[model samples]
Target: MTGGGWRRTLPLMPASIPSASRENKKKIPYAWELVGWLWLAYFMNQADRQLYSVVQKQVQEALGLTDIQTGLVNTVLIAAMAVMMPIAGFLGDRLSRRRIILWSLLAWSVATMLTGFTGGLVSLIVIRSLATAVGEAFFVPAATALIGQYHVKTRGQALAFYQTAQYFGAVSCGAAGGWIAGQYGWKHSFWLFGGVGVVLVALMWRRLKDAPKTAAAIACSEPIGDVLRALFRTPTALVLTLALGCSTFVNMGCLAWAPTYLQLEPFNLTPARAGFFSMFYYQLFSFAGVLLGGRVSDKIVGRRPAFRVELSGVSLLLCVPTLYLMGATSTLWVVYAMLGAFGFFRGLYDSNIYASLFDVTAPRYHSSATGLMVGFSFAVGSLAPLALGAIKQSYALHTGISLLGVVYIIGSLALFIAARGFFPSDFLRNQQTVPTSPKL
Candidate 1:
């Protein structure tokens, strides 16, 4: 079917129809240039967010806020991101992806810089949560979609490279934020990271360029209603969205509170040590996992179309025991090993999360689909910080963290069901094109 015909029958068509119908463009080396800078952008993306968690103790003390309030700060940031996901996705489909990303980086950088000057809760909420999150929300859908456009054959590896920046950013910021806060002050940590981000904005503006348009890009400009209608109708997409929500629930809760947990009771580590331990062990192994999973998936995807979702499910199931033991055990060595194991599985899961979504989604609707999924996931998952915070207040931090295992279990089950049942049909559907009637 022609692109125009597919538009009319979009509800029945699979996501890859647009791209598959288009003539293959010559593979461009510019793909490398694109992912390179995007890696940096994502690094800053996560680092800026993770800083709040590392410095939450000091922020609470200085601001005279409670645990719930600290959680509220993260809640607000995530909520802002969630609210903007659809808007971001729509714009990404229509606008210059490079320009969207540059502006996003600039907006978030400015917000991060202003975060240094906050006087109280109101200022923090305005600068750190609202403004910064709005900027950050514009990034992922556009950037990921753009990368997909460039590296059709190398999608997994390119995305895996992008995923590594997340691990490094979280680890570095979590550790560095603690030390910076201890010595120079928490405000200075914001100033330092924010300043670097601003400098990168100038660099990205000069370096980054969007991919040349193709049938997929042209087709992607469909109205928002059409995009959403098609996306919502796909069972695989819906399942993945719920699965992502479950992943985020565990991730957001742990990222916000793990350092604080380590600083208390049995271990009693200093802020810097707690920060390092909380992220370093897990992310380090996660770093390796992305590399391993990406290569493995790329090699096997042709033979096993459902491998991405299957891998995600298996990884999450593996995380269940590790997450439970990480909190239940008092042995630091046991905790550390479990954290690494958890990170490995998570890395394996993370490597393919979006790639799996892309498999079932049309290239034209990539950004919008990403936005809907991310927005929904983040909105639902935003409750994690507050929910876990409240749980911690009522019970032990270990118990709060242990409860995350249950979320992982549910997510794992969803993915497994999708992998076994939904993926084959959906993937095969993308390969089938329905013919449109001749013009009257």
Candidate 2:
């Protein structure tokens, strides 16, 4: 694809790729604009997910649901998202991503709005778990692949900035959703956030433009089996996927339970205050970590392709102690400090998840590859809520949460091994297999 129109210029290509790429210097600004749009989209995506947890307590009491039932609901939603990832990823590769993203936003937003109207657990499962999951599942693969396609030169930083939306959405919505639930009702909170998502959809429809379909992209678009085989054959990809699974397990459990944990026992904060404290300090420092990690990775990856993996390893290791401390400490200030440190390192690890995946996988398989990675991670993570809920019945929340440190330690080791052994070969292999030109 030419570097004109909505398509941005390709950066350094593999030595084996053809050198006849079209040179257009124009679309650079548009790339950043695309990032901006994605930032909003991702914000909505995360905020919508957090809505359930933010008001889960109220919903549980209103519906006379058990903790296990609440966990089941979270599991169903995450499982549905996992199940849809491959299909969504496949479509993202062949279809218009812009259109896919637009429709996804519309579908999930509508579901979120409709969630307010639910009268029972069955309806909540139908709307929030099944429908919402199906809609939201289509977003990440297409959106992240689009960013990877355009912002190749500034990919790390761009993606990092895009990820900050997660922190923003989670932290802000955690507080806002709790306040809304308390002031109005949990139902109105859903309505408010869902309405905001719908507005963003209109904005995206007007501003977001698709890149021109190019011959190289068409030629490179391989069958689903081929894409899967190519990605899975690489040891680095396998290791990375497993590591992500471990990370997701910790993340999903912590995010789903943190506020609830804070509301109980030693820190008995109210819903709004609990939500605020749960996400505020942790995500606040995390935002800085992501930006810093991205900038550092981009600047250093040339000389050290293993930089991303190493960073992830170190971050995960750091997170292990912080996570454990957050649970073990009875002192609220100590818990807060540990959580802040945990968030910072977690962000550092998260900033390169997709970037590291792209480093090994071919450009042609970006969407599908992302789908598989995300699908696997979420599928494993889906079990966390249920497991944690069950554990909470028999043990303290702190005990269950501290177990997450083990998962982080395992993931850290796996990544360290990948960096030392598999990364260089996988990185080289992907570069050689794909076209040099950036496809719009």
The local distance difference test score of each candidate is: 0.85, 0.86
lDDT of 2 by residue, 205-289 (tens): 9888765554324424667788778877989988889989999999999999998988998899899988888999989999999
Which residue runs does candidate 2 get wrong by more than 4 Å? 1-28, 219-221, 438-440
lDDT for 65 in candidate 2 is 89
Each candidate's number of clashing pairs is 1, 0
lDDT of 1 by residue, 66-177 (tens): 8898899999999989999878988899989989999999899889989988878988998999999999999999999988877665788899989999999999998888
Worst 10 residues of 2 by lDDT: 1-10
How much is the lDDT of residue 400 in candidate 2?
89
TM-scores of the candidates in the order shown: 0.91, 0.93
After superposition, candidate 1 runs with Cα above 4 Å error = 1-28, 433-440
- Output the lDDT of residue 351, model 1: 93
**In candidate 1, how many clashes are counted?**
1
lDDT (Cα) of model 1: 0.85
Query: Against the true structure, whose TM-score is highest?
Result: 2
